[model samples]
Target: MRTNGDLNNTSAAREVARIDIDAAHSYRSLAISEAEDDATIRKSYRPFLLSPEITSTDWISKLELSTVVKLAEEDLHKTGERLKVLVLYGSLRERSYSRLLAFEASRILFRLGCDVRVFDPTGLPMKDDVQHNQPKVQELRDLGRLERRPCLGLCRATWESHCRLQKPNRLDPPLRRLRRPTQGRTLAIAQVSGGSQSFNAVNSLRLLGRWMRMFVIPNQSSVPMAYTQFTDERLADPVEGGSRMIPSGNRMRIVDCMEEFVKYTILMRPHFALFGDRCSEREERVEKERKATEKARKEAEEKRVE
Candidate 1:
């Protein structure tokens, strides 16, 4: 997670340079243990990084990359704050298409001057499998709670390969336990399908966002025939190409969705309090406090009169 030295490196390298700082620094430096070191090095424990790179075409052309930077900078200039974004993707396949797409969106967000963290759900336990203190579970909760503001959450939720082969939903189990952190967050959904284009996954994600009290954006991306969407040879040989997970044709839509997502998050930043304030919850708390005060005063008056 060396952030400072390698601006000129390939696009893939630049992306990996932005792994979540918290994930990298989770363990203390003064105390070293073999188990801790193993966890840090394992692919699942740390935030995802691109596999080693080889010389290849840039995932994004220099011109396009510059345009994205300029537009994002212009739009976000007034805020004067770096947006904190958390990306969550489903699927644990070695080459999950959802992960690839998440990485692509992360790059755009990073260029937009966002402090982005992608939660790796690989080893995450089921909701009942363990307590909140489980390492992976804690990592995700920490990321979700990174900012109380309505910062952006780019979620790529997916079903099985092509159809209704329902495996345990990777995100829902973990996120159900994360309602506190997710409340008032802004979410953008994307889904990948192995066959034809389908909104099933994204639609389900939208429902989940609603249940979580998140601001789900209107714009979304669904890539059909996803297996063909990414370059194969490039991803397989880490040394032969820049990165295989780079999306080929659906790049424009993905970028557009991310742009809208970022802009909406910026637009909503000023009203975080408005979004977070729950009238019913606040009223209930106030009622309880009032009752307690009344009881206390009655007891004091009775004792004094006696």
Candidate 2:
């Protein structure tokens, strides 16, 4: 008794019901999977401790420490001196991923017994507009002179082939004046990308470090889709089933990079003074001075003969 239109309506209703049922089943599966992940995490809970001699772990809460590295008596620095690290970020955003990453790095470096200093670039002026007496500029330059190791955290913007200009690039003009005097100092680079993982920013930072006469460390970190990687101001642990398929899943990469940086700094600190002692450059300067002296002597002799 039903027309063709009524048949079509009945079929559409059945299709809608089927879709609803499937959606409910998908939601239930997702919930169960999340619960399993949580349970696994609880069962495998471990603290992340870098040094075995750590007596107090009151400062560590979020970072899960499992590995304990014990240094031999000969391997330890006899001076008991701590490595000084300077951390700089390129962004000024309130919720800047670069800043967050820098903070995370500072935490790791501190736990490793390094004196970490995070430079705030707020109120810093551009290179052209900067004055020598400016407080922020002086602070940055002082830190540059004092700290032997620098770690840069850069923010990658949306652009084709390259990222946009960053605020920290302004630091080059002042630091460049140091020239070869600051050569052989260690540098570490880290970057955060808003979209996918990209090294454009870190690559650019490497070039900058080279220009500044710093030795950029071999290990670098480029975090992808930074927004999802952080939870409650801390990097989310993405390790499930003891695997880190996602590049930015584990913060251990950053920890490893920092460890390498500290090692490099220790290795090169004793040889820093030797970097500026280039025999060739010094000889060239001496030759120029000798030529100038000879020319002046010739001029004086001609005047006496006349």
- List the global CA lDDT of all models: 0.64, 0.57
Q: State the TM-score for model 1.
A: 0.71
Highest lDDT against the true fold, candidate: 1
lDDT, candidate 1, 110-159, per-residue tens: 54566666777878766576566888777776666645434455455454
| Alpha-carbon runs more than 4 Å astray in model 2 | 1-77, 146-162, 233-250, 285-306
Model 1, residue pairs in steric clash: 235-244
Candidate 2 collision pairs:
47-64, 47-65, 47-66, 48-64, 48-65, 48-66, 49-65
Residue-level lDDT of model 2, residues 1-306, one tens digit each, is: 765568556655644432122322221100012233344322322112123222133223223332211221112346455566677776778777677667667656555555556666777777864497788788767766734434222211211124643565555666666555457778888887777778887787788778877888898887777776665434433322111222344466776676577667766766667766789999999999999999999999999999
Model 1, backbone clash pairs (residues 3+ apart or across chains), number: 1
Q: Return the TM-score for candidate 2, rounded to 2 decimals.
A: 0.62
Question: Which one is best on TM-score?
Answer: 1
